[model samples]
Target: MAGDPPTTPSSTQTGVPNNGNNPSPSEDPNNGNSPSSTDFASLPSATATGDINSTDKGLDGGAVAGVAVGCLIAGLIIGAIVMWLVFRAKGSRYTRRRRRSEDRGRLMHSTRDANLVALESSRKPMKLENFILQPAPDKEIISDLSRLDDIIRQHVETVYHFEPVDVKVTALAHSLTAIGYSERLSGLQVEDVATWCLQTETRCGALRHVLSHVLFSSIDWNSPGALTLLPQPAIGFLNSIRPIGEYRNNFDVMSFAWTRWRTLSALFLHPSPQERTPLEVSEDDIQGQVETLAKALDPVLRYFVAPDEESQHQQHDHLRVMIMETAKLGYTLFSHTSDWKFIYRDDSGKRCPVLCIGLEKLCGSDGYRLVSPQRIVEPRVMS
Candidate 1:
């Protein structure tokens, strides 16, 4: 090769350009046909890759955090709802229990109120008996006596005077004489006479008052004094009037009296000794005696006494024996008076026999023995 071209150094040996001062095509900066030093495939593009990875990581983290927070919020809501439901259920149960307890308490109170004790069986029976024997207040006695006088006056004017003026005068004189003679024979003071008159009038007035209001207008024709006449809410009230054993008898007595006295006046209707024939004098006297005996007995007997030998005869004998004994003592029997403590006293001290009986049956010794009205407790029901 040296002989052929006395040659210059090859480019590979000197690591320089074959042409002096000229760069090879691969190393020339201006060379368009040669490879450049920048290798896009081998050198990593760290800036762009790092930026993209950081952004993706940030997005993923945000998504995870959002999911966690959302789950936590959902769980909290569910827990709150469950707790609310549990508390509500507990509250409802507690309310039910409270209501049941209240109802039981009310029922017990009502039962206690309805159970009555007999006055005769009380611990202080003797005291109660003495109290019962005491006469009613003077104000009430005077009012009742005045009323009886008015009724007698009306009867004389309306019925006795219808026949003849002379008969009317005779009838008036006989009535006055009978009352006056009875008072004198009994050796009664003016107050005592007035009291006796009041007792008689009150006994008769009670029946008349009941008949005037209940029998004439309020009675059911098919079933007199039936409980159906009361309101539905008052069924319990009706049951509270008498004990289970005595309700029927008492109710029947009331009904019978109401009906019987509806057509009759409360005043006594009898023939005077002057009006009677000589043959009828003994019978008239006996009848007057019987009338006085009947008035002395318990007023309840007038309605409840049976006509059989077991009741009416025995009652009659007892009254007859009592009258005879009273006569033997020289204490005239006709003008005698007895106190009826079975009657109730209102705020004004007026006697209300029916109300007294009702209260005695309903409230027992608690109300009957006390001077005040009984207090009752009512039940509370949940809506």
Candidate 2:
């Protein structure tokens, strides 16, 4: 300690002299670099703001890191929501398609059931209005009428035999002469074939006998032979003609009914002979049809009798009864046509017969037509 020199800072700080012969000052051990008694203190307290600037810079770095992390998490959340919505839309579309498929299946099954019932009803010919149609959903059940016409034609051919044609044609001529029947032909009054045959008075063959009863001549009919045969036959023949209903509107049926329409029509144009009879037809053939239908229906209709009062107004309604009754016993209206003659016993026990024939004058553009039980009434023309 005695050899140690005095610290240099004491001299410089204190500006004290180190008298070589004098002793060291810490010699007193009282001072370090704490301060010199005569010097002022140097201090960093004036620049304390630099520490604040460094702290603010560190806080800004932490805030930026926090914002970047929050943005990344928010983006992940939005992305999840968008994916969920897309999946939801796909699921909804699937459900809608499945529901539609089920509905179509149900509709198909119901349609099949309705179709079956309609088809069965048509086969039985049930009341057309009541049957619900699924397949052929036509407004009118009667729209397809060709089938009905075919059925009626088949029935006619089945019933009428052809053998009676000649007898009917022969009988028609006799009744014509007995009655004064005339036709206006070529604008000149030409007597009909029937009239021509009967009044001829010339002792001649069968065909020529019809010719003499031409124009308007008195036919002296005898009580026996040809004249005698004309009466009941006349009634039968007259009953054969009937009024048919117009199921379809033909331009001709559309034309109002006028008297002796065909004869008047002939005046406008020289009608083809085919117009008088059907094409591919001879007088012999159509006359055959008349006799065939007449003979066949006579027995068939006669055999089908009416029910008693016990079952009065049963299955056959009054409408049907009137129609059928007229068909069977309604002879009072039947004595006018030329096909047969009518004979009746007036209470005098004598057979006084009146003669009538089919008036070519009354038949319309169509020739004589017959009505059957099941036939629909439409004015039937030769065509």
Candidate 3:
């Protein structure tokens, strides 16, 4: 022991053994001499773990943001494409509609031109002197027209139809005569007479109103063969001849009625050379229309004429004369003068106001003063 270096005693040599149950003071579990197996220094630092977790979260967030941006761009592209398609569709529809409207306009103009051409082709030339209108004598078969004359003469001098007083009187007299022959209407009521006179004047007024538009009666209604030759005014005159609601107002129907009116008007103005024979209109449509018109006007005639068949026949003859004279006078006035118009029912369907006692003759009176017109018997005439 003296020669050797000082050797620490082993646990066995020192007579105390290190075992599971006992240990030296330096190795004691309670002493702080040795490091323990569960020491806190052996674990990772808090800052280092937090840095790793933060890097993983950053990667995940970047992926989500990239996907969201890609979806937004795709949605915008799709919205733009849809808007383009919608506008293009609307534009195409509008173009198609405009083309159709243009086509309809061209068709209407062409149809009108064709009708005019056909009318001029098959017409015969005749002088107006062959079928001129004549005024009624003061004492022709009827004696009670004095009051009617007084009423007519007062307005005749005015520029109602812009005609001479004589012409107006002749036209109005023929119009009233056409209601029925003098003998047939002897038993009728005063109200009926007023009705007949008012209606005739109204029809005449309507004719003249349209005549003011188409004054070239010589170039216009020079022949009575075809309806196509007829001016629009002629068509309007025929349509207005019948009271409103009497027949269908279709163009074709009105054209047919015009043919009938023209034929009858011609016959009355110029009797057939044979006298007993029917007037010879070139178109078969005119002949058929004449018969049709007779039947159509029968109901109208029955209201004013006597029930006898002979009286009815005579009344139709007179009616034809009336229409012819009114047309003749209307043509004369429109051709010669420029200051007249018939005041039709207002757009609201109200009657025209009573302006002056000298111009308009009311159908009836309440005591001495006239009441508001229930019906526009004679439409007001004005300059």
Q: Which candidate wins on TM-score? A: 3
**Greater-lDDT candidate between 2 and 3:** 3
| Candidate 3: residue 270 lDDT (0-100) | 38
TM-scores for every predicted model? 0.23, 0.23, 0.28
Tens digits of lDDT, candidate 2, 203-302: 1222212221221011111111221111233324334544223324542332222112322232222225333321121233234333433332232222
Summarize candidate 3's per-residue lDDT along 17-94 as a digit string, tens digits.
566676666666797767666555655575678889898776587788999999999999999999999999999999
Residue pairs of candidate 1 with colliding backbone atoms: none
Roughly what TM-score does model 2 have, to 2 decimal places?
Answer: 0.23
- Model-by-model lDDT, in order? 0.35, 0.32, 0.38
Q: Which pairs clash in the backbone of model 3?
A: none
